[model samples]
Target: MDLAWVRQHVRQAAAELGFGLVDQTKLVTAASELARNTLVHGGGGQVESTVLQNGLARGLRLTFTDEGPGIPDIERALSDGYTSGGGLGLGLGGARRLVHEFSLDSRPGAGTAVTVICWVAGPPRQRKEMR
Candidate 1:
């Protein structure tokens, strides 16, 4: 249920930001993957979505966090094929590749948090002459 919500939320945001079809697809796909990892691996978590703008470029950001047993090996976790659960192990790495920015934080006993952002090139910003 929550994962679906996550995907929907991202989709709406992408649409609202005028993201192209490719951008929308990438953002939603990344969000779904990360949300699933947050639930199955992190033992359930929360996601925060936000919109960003920089010089006419728009972006959607999703942050997922959980209080479950944190990942013990960050290196292995982000590696090509690694899974703490019974899955294909492409969730994290693949999700990261789909987004423009990705960040993950976890401690031995604290928990885990993953943040990703997908950006679309909006109209170019105008440059003023220094004359």
Candidate 2:
């Protein structure tokens, strides 16, 4: 949907998953920046969020995809103080720092996709226990 909606949704999801206030704020901030980048630079895209489990850790993963022109220099894009747009240029790098896992894919004329994950350590549980 929109940036605000995305931010709110992400914050709620993080909270529901038992994230602390600081972690929740980090997720919301990251989601907002990426959502804005999708709408403004990517000309609109989709953001998908899901809960994840791996042994004793629980995590939240967010994937953003866009059909607009892809990034030509992913390295530069991820570097601090770099922006094709006239914004503050902390969107990508800052968001990456807020998450446990970060990935980005882009091809000049094709599109761009970004995935980020944040994990919280917990007691180990079986997969069935999650159900």
For candidate 1, list the clashing residue pairs, or say none: none
In candidate 2 the C-alpha lDDT for residue 59 amounts to 91
lDDT of 1 by residue, 24-93 (tens): 8888888888888888878898999888888878888889999989988888778877766665456688
> Which regions of candidate 1 are displaced past 4 Å?
85-89, 123-131
Residue pairs clashing in model 2 are: none
lDDT of 2 at 81: 76
**Whole-model lDDT for model 1 versus the true structure?**
0.83
For TM-score, the strongest prediction is 2
* Alpha-carbon deviation at 5 in model 2, angstroms: 0.8
* C-alpha lDDT of residue 99 in model 1: 90
Given candidate 1, what's the lDDT at residue 1? 81
